[model samples]
Target chain A: MKNMYEILINALQADELIAQVTILNGSNVGEKLLLWPDGRKYGGLGSEKLEKQIIEKAKELFQRQETRKLEFELDEGRISIFIQVYPPSPRMIVVGAVHIAVPLTELGKTMGFRTIVVDARSAFATRERFPHVDEIIVKWPSEALEALHPDEGTYVAILSHDAKFDIPALQVPVQSKAKYVGVLASKHTYSILHEALRENGVSEALLGKVHTPIGIKKLGSRGPEGIAFSVMAEMIAEMRGVEIT
Target chain B: MRDVMENISNWREEGKQIVLATVVKAYGSALRPIGSKMAISSAGDISGSVSGGCVESAVYEEAQSVLANSEPRLVEYGIADETAWSVGLTCGGTIEVFLELLD
Candidate 1:
């Protein structure tokens, strides 16, 4: 018999969507069925009918990317199973090596995100500055974003606070599947950038997706570290589906 | 779970019998969410935790029985549970844990 633990570790290491179904009730309590996205099965949940039903449910939960415990009324009895879905960790694309970006990248890693720091200046985006960042890209905003390819699990932060860099950086992420696209700027700067982006052919709906004056509201972060912390707090709230004031 | 696997592997190399416990479900504000796991060696060595600090001793006792019978079982704990006075969790939430022999 194949070890379920080995299969679990392998799926996790490969960043695959692996669903673990544990029967909590019925005659087969504690039986497990590990399902991979490719339809590979590691173990059985006792009966073929039950396994098929549970696999269909698992696929639905995987789409939502959530872990849930559910109860079903079968002829045998009421059966409960915990469907735990493990997806790849989210990615944080920090589009500046500024003071705020330094702490933001650190907070990203601490919060279990794969952090990447991108800057056009090689001097700023050096290994010494961000020792813990997963990847450091010494390229401009357009080129960096083109290579990074923001997806549903990606969070993009434009921390340069300069229109020259921030404008170009904001264009792609606003339309990408990134869950969050935030730009650090003041009220006046934000207004100007929004107008510029609108004139540059970005739709209002797309610009609406951008989070300006980034971070949780009323956080009152005075220092760069405090701002970074607030940003991470906002990211966490967004990820957990919690609304922030 | 990584911690449990690492220690379970080491215990297996030493020829020590072991049992595994996993938090299958957590309801109403549990500290550790579902899918948390722990391993118990026959020698009483423990790795990982399903609950932060509550109900571990109870799970440890259950592990002993599971290792003996080689049968998996489900155990639940909560603040106002039937075993409230004996091994109740003060976490104010319910957690269902499944125990199985891993040896």
Candidate 2:
């Protein structure tokens, strides 16, 4: 049996999603309840009813992915509990060793994402090219993504504009649970790739989720860094759930 | 809080008395979001930040008081026109910080 602080530090070090509920008011001030999304719990805030209510509120905050303070009126008095969620660090998976991948990886790293680069070309995916990236998988995008298990916290960028690579790269993330899947392509190239994917039996709904001609609109810039900037901007907007007109 | 966890652990291992301050609530354009934390040791060392160089000194003082008394406190800071030179956020935001001694 571990103390609440030890349990919290362990969960954080393991990159597990956990929530901390702390009573801010009432007699239970400074009381804490640590909760996991799977219903695992540690510590308590005294009352069973209060704990149940805090668990329910923690679930809602987990869905919202935010820290919030809620006021609850109990039979004894009004209690305010602050629910703070600790989610795993987000990841950025780039499926290319192209020039944009360099700055894109750098930007992702700077933005606090665990950046991984995937490419079949051993020479291009060398550590020399991506010194700061968390991982460089010298394998095909499909295989790398399959092993990586991109989840809701993952953002995938298919920067290999070549059809042979881009098509295979797009196949995994577009259909996976990745939060954002974007592809770098010209309008002409995207149409061709779109048709090719559709021909390969990809559904319209899934294909519709893919961000082709990737990056924010009206970027009005050219070159690798500019494109990376736009792509990161788009990814940030998607991560923040902001609608970009 | 994540950013300062390692430091907090190190301080705890060294048998240092530590106070943890967390931003429990924010209003308006708060520079730091809710759940941001700052850790202060009895030796006056600090880790992480609760605001963009605003209200931290005040929070530090409050942390010292909490360390001395072993009592938790929730303090609110907001910009006041009358007390223009006081400790408050220049970003025109209000933030409530909870300070507690970390055992």
Candidate 3:
């Protein structure tokens, strides 16, 4: 009984991946069709043929995770539909609740990411320290990542400077489908960590994906807040598909 | 859409008629990306924005007409448009906005 707008709002609120197709041109202007990833559809554009065409186009857009406007030529006339895909919001998973994690999480939240903080040190990963983070997990990085299941929409930051923690933390994200995995380490530390990860059986291809000495180059930024800024800049670049040499 | 959802829901709860305007296409350095949206209530209240304060007033006016007739419309703004120049996109971009009543 709910209207299409209410239904669309509910689906978005529930964090469900959905595609909304709006007829921008043609006799049925303003008509909409909602497509779920699981092949469920609602509403119509007045004709079975047009709906079928839109469903096919929606599937392709869903795969690309893109919003696009397409013009279709029919026997009657030209129909244009704006297809908008609503995916779950991206997440920022900080693997260490260090000083940088504070501003990093803050920046993540400001950038509309679901920020999470993880640390094995209970003393470090406290609500008092991360009062605004969406979630704080006081567990080893590997375990936390395993439970969280980092997906292609997740950006992982390994700020556990110590190798004992860093090595284990690096292992999980490097093998998972996380979109970005950045580590805060100096050149010397990165080389050492690189060897250790290789010893742990991480493939060269996967290890190559890890962003070392993390953050934008030549930033000249120093200290916790500065480093966090650079790291976030790099993450944004990655998220927006911008390449920075 | 997410950015304007809270205000849209609040306006809906107050029984205000609403129009949702979305930027369906942006060409040349548009300030807001495609799919950016703004919600306009019948009382002239607005939430979110589709441009960098360049065209909200114009879009708001169009939304009022849509609310009156319950007809959706597509509006375009560009620096080259003489009428749009009065409330043009200072960013020198062309944008096509789709306005529809939120039923």
Better of 1 and 3 by lDDT: 3
Considering the two chains of model 2, state its CAPRI-style docking category. Answer: medium
Cα miss at A22, model 3 (Å)?
1.3
Better of 2 and 3 by DockQ: 3
Tell me the whole-model lDDT of each prediction, alpha carbons only. Answer: 0.85, 0.88, 0.91
Please list all clashing residue pairs in model 2, or write none if there are none.
none
Q: Candidate 1 DockQ category?
A: medium
Question: Candidate 3 on A80-149: residue-level lDDT in tens?
Answer: 7899998888899998899999999999988878899999999999999999998999998888999988
- Residues B1-103 of candidate 3 have per-residue lDDT tens digits of 8889889999999999999999999999888988999999998789999998898888998888999999999989998876579976689898999999998
* Model 1, span A1-245: residue lDDT tens: 66786778777656687888888767888788888777888888778888888888887888887788888777798888888888787899999899999999999987768899999999999999999998999999868997788998999999988898988889888878888999999999999989989999999999987877899768887699999999998888777778776
C-alpha DockQ of every model: 0.51, 0.70, 0.81
lDDT of 3 at B102: 92
Candidate 1: misplaced stretches above 4 Å? A24-30, A70-80, A126-128, B1-20, B38-49, B60-71, B82-88, B101-103
**Deviation (Å) of A114 in candidate 1:** 2.9
Best candidate, DockQ: 3
Model 3 chain A poorest 10 in a row by lDDT: A213-222
